[model samples]
Target chain A: MPGKALVITSGKGGVGKTTTTANLGLGLALRGHKVALVDADTGLRNLDVVMGLENRIVYDLVDVIEGNCRLAQALIRDKRTRNLVLLPTAQSKEKDAVKPEQMKELVKQLKDEFDYILIDSPAGIEHGFRNAVAGADEAIIVTTPEVAAVRDADRIIGLLEASGLYDPSLIINRVRPDMVRRGDMMDIDDIIEILAIPLLGVVPDDEGIIISTNRGEPVVLNGRCRSGEAFNNIVRRLEGEEVPFLDMRGDGLLEKLKRLVGLR
Target chain B: MWEFLSRLFGRENEASKVAAKERLRLVLVHDRTTVSPCLLETLKEELLDVISKYMEIDQAGFEVNIEQGDDSMALVANIPIKEMKRALSRTKN
Candidate 1:
């Protein structure tokens, strides 16, 4: 069977949209699944950088779209995993350089060959975002457990529903369990209550993500990272497996403190 | 007493909740329904105008608020009897 086309999107920027894409792609690929991650941000691409495949990109998505190169030529195989490929976007061209129809066709071509086609959508509900979701089998809405992020996620949920795409799952990123315990930040339940989407993964705030990204290594490469485990859980959920949410902090005390400080 | 104690005990929590509810309601009202605050105000004024000509409206106690969450904006107008009495007294007199 062909793979699932998953669009990882968050309407708000700086809410870990790209991180979710990078880690989830690696997580699924690590599970022996053939995964292809398409950076749909177009000109403002960073999936290549996050995936550590920037040096390998001789041809990009635009190259394949414009017939400058074959799709295979554009696809850069992961130095770490053969099953994973990074379909990078051209940094020179703007988001509208490639149309949604073109993206649809491209994802369709890769569908049969891959187990998961994860597209990283640009922040904001614009042409870039639309093109990213044009061929999504399902959408994994990434958001932090903040009111602003959750509000934006709710808007994206509305847009997805308006577009006739319902049942999009939620990926709560940077959830500080301590803050959640203290009620300084919105907890998983609060987020779930607000977004009302099925939970795919609950990623805790981890400083290691920055270190890994700085090294051109995805957090998923490190099994010990909380974010990595969360990504793995999401991948398993995508495979229709039931994996429990991973609370980075062992106790809910922090969640309570966050609530006390009005950070939740 | 318990309510007061709970309220006092969870003062920070209550404040955050109140703040979250207020902000979310304000932001999401426009975000979900695409209705601007000016338009909503205009609508409220128009609604009050049309209704005031009839039985009674408590203009001071009247509130046109938008409920946020789930489907976003849910317009709720609350006009108090005291407001209607006050309006009726001011206008009729």
Candidate 2:
């Protein structure tokens, strides 16, 4: 049976697209499904580093596309999970080096060999973003709670719908619960109202995420952290499990007082 | 005390969130339509010019806005006609 191909994208940069790709890919692999993580950013590749497979990148996606290496040879097997593989992008190549048809063909070939193919898209609606989303059956849009991020996500969702990929789910990342409770930051409800997409999961702003990335390890590997649990919920939801969204309301004394006085 | 009381009672008055949503709503209407504010202004000017030839319009009350429907966007124009000059000319003849 053919597997599913999903592209993780955000029209805005630094909204956790690569991190979500690494975690979700590893999360699926840990569930015993053979998964392939494709770093489609081409010139600016970081998925490999996030997955801790950067040092083993002997060949990359461009090598396979240009016939310099076989597809299997370009796939770097993860050290922790044998079922998870990384198809790193060529750091030196430009975004136009690969076309949409080529991406579609490559993902088609990958779908037969793996249970899931997760493409990590680059930021913006330009050639790189187009190349990343070309082959996917579904899309996961990641956004922070900031206004700019949500606005960009809304534009990306419109473009995706125009391209015939409708109903793309959302991942609200880097949410500061305290700020949200204080009405200083946009909450999940506000984001959903603007983006108008189904909720996938919300990842809290975690300092551990920085440490994990620094160590070239995905946060999902720990499972004890808040962001790690969020990624796990995304994985479960992807597998047809109805996982409830995390209640990220920080019930501090001030929050309680505000709620009592109807100031929240 | 008045400000504090208003803040206490207005629980849903999240200034930033409300502002962001309003800004996004207005911007996305233009973004999706690919219509610039300049273009809309030009269009309104041309529409008024063409319509004023046939009737005296309430220029101060005229309004143009892009409204978002369930699945599509519509450019709505409310041109209040004060008097029909063409009808007055016909009546005189």
Candidate 3:
């Protein structure tokens, strides 16, 4: 059976699109499925740095498309796992350097060999976004709880629908449970009501994310943070497993007691 | 006591999230409508001009809005008519 191509995108930048792509791609590969992450952001390539495979990138998407290198030479195998590979993008090329048809053909080839091809799209509704989504069979939108991010997610949903990509799921990132409890931030229901997309999972704003990113390790591999656990659950959901949402309130009596003793 | 308690609880004013939700609601409506205010304004004016030749419409009461629906959107306009104009006499050619 051929694998599915899913694009991870957000209309706004700095909303963790690359982070989610790296985590989800690795999460699926850890489950023994062959996965390939395609960085379609072209000039603004980032999946390499996020995945800690920057130094190993001998070729990129543009090289493969331009026939400068073969497809096998461009794919960088993960240092930790052989099942997952990354097809990095050329940082020096423009967004229009690669055509939509080329991307579609590339993803089609990857689908035959991998269980999942997660295309990490660039931020915006421009050519970069279009090329990234060209060969996608499904789409995952990453957004924060902020107004601008939510609004852009809504706009992306409309654009996706116009292009015949229907019912894209949402992943809300950088959620602050304490702020939500204090009514200082928007809650899950508020965002769901506004965006009206199926909720895949929510990741808390854990400091572990910053540490893991700096260390060039995905949070899912850490396996200690709440955000990592949340990502694991999302992976299960993608595999048709019904995992319950994590308890993010963080105000339970036990937690409060721990906080009192400075054990948190 | 109530005043002091309210102050202490920081409940004297509404939560800022309420305002965020309200603003997002309004903005999403405009975004989803997919029609610019300038375009809508021009359409409203042209519609009024076309309708005025046949009847006297209540210009102050005329309103145009985009009613969003599930899987569809409608351009709804409410133009109140005060009176119909009599047809002008025409000589046979």
Candidate 4:
């Protein structure tokens, strides 16, 4: 059977789209599925750096599209796992270098080989966004809790619907539970109620994310941090397992207070 | 410290998230409808012109807004009328 193609997108930049892509793709591969992480950002590619496979990328998405290299030659196999590979895009090409039809064809070919193909889209609702979304069977909208990020998420949701990819699930990333406890940050409930989509999972803001990114090692490999556990839940959820959300309400004292005030 | 005290005192309702929610609600209403504040202003002027033909309306008190509900939306117009026209001149019945 062919694999599934899922595009990870957020209309606004700096909301962890690339990080989510790398972690989720690697997370799936760690579970014994053959996964391909495609960087569709073209001119401003970052997934290669995040995956720590930058030195291995002699070929890219543009090279494969223009018949410069075979698909097998362009894919960079992860050093950590034999099941995972990344098809990095060119850092020199423009967003218009690859067309939507070409993206669709590339995804089709990838679906035959891998169990999951995760496309990391560029920020904004322009050509790059369209190209990233064109080939996917489903979309995972990633957004932070801030007003600007959620607003852009709302717009991306509308655009996804307009493009015939409906009912895309959401991942609320970088949620600060302490802020939510203080009612200073928007909670999961607020984001869910606003987006009105099925919840995949929620990732907490972790300092370990910085350390992992610095070393080009995915946080999921650590498997101890809150954000790592959250990504694992999302990976399982994608595989159709029913995993409950983490109780990010801090320790016992705050938990008791939250329960007293009817907050979760 | 003040923030912690407010949370402890059950004053969480007044937290900044309330303001964020309200702001997101208003902004999304405009975004989903693709209607800008400028467009709403122009629409209000045109609506006042048509409503004035039948009744005297309070222009200052006239308001038009798009309110979002759970699973539905409403284009609500709150127009205060001074008096209804007693004589029907352009009545085509």
TM-scores, all candidates, are: 0.77, 0.79, 0.84, 0.80
Report lDDT (CA) for all predictions.
0.83, 0.89, 0.91, 0.92
Q: State fnat for each of the candidate structures.
A: 0.18, 0.39, 0.61, 0.67
**Per-residue lDDT over A88-123 for candidate 3, one digit per residue giving the tens place of the 0 to 100 score:** 999998889899999999999999999999999999
Candidate rank order under DockQ: 3, 4, 2, 1
Identify the superior model by TM-score, candidate 3 or candidate 4.
3
Model 2, clash count? 0
Please report the TM-score between candidate 1 and the true structure: 0.77
CAPRI quality level assigned to candidate 4 from its DockQ score = acceptable
lDDT of residue A205 for candidate 2: 91
DockQ of 2: 0.29
How does model 2 score by TM-score? 0.79
Report the C-alpha lDDT of model 1 over A55-81, residue by residue, as the tens digit: 887999999999998998989899888
Writing each residue's lDDT as its tens digit, candidate 3 over B1-93 gives 998897579664346778788888878877777887899999999999888877899999999988877545789999999998886332222
Q: Model 1 scores what on Cα lDDT?
A: 0.83
**What is the per-residue lDDT of model 1 for residues B1-93, given as tens digits with 9 covering 90 to 100?**
877886678767646644664576567667767766899889989988777755576677777877766545577888765423334554554
Give lDDT tens digits, candidate 2, residues A1-264. 999999999999999999999999999999999999999998999998888888898999999999999999999999999999999999999889999999999999999999999999999999988888899999999999886888789889988886678999999999988778767677888788877889999999989899999998899997767789889999999999999988777657886697588774
Candidate order, TM-score descending: 3, 4, 2, 1
Best by TM-score: 3
Model 1 stretches with alpha carbons more than 4 Å out: A248-264, B1-14, B35-93
Grade the docking of candidate 3.
acceptable
Q: Give the 10-residue window scoring lowest on summed lDDT in candidate 3 chain A.
A: A247-256
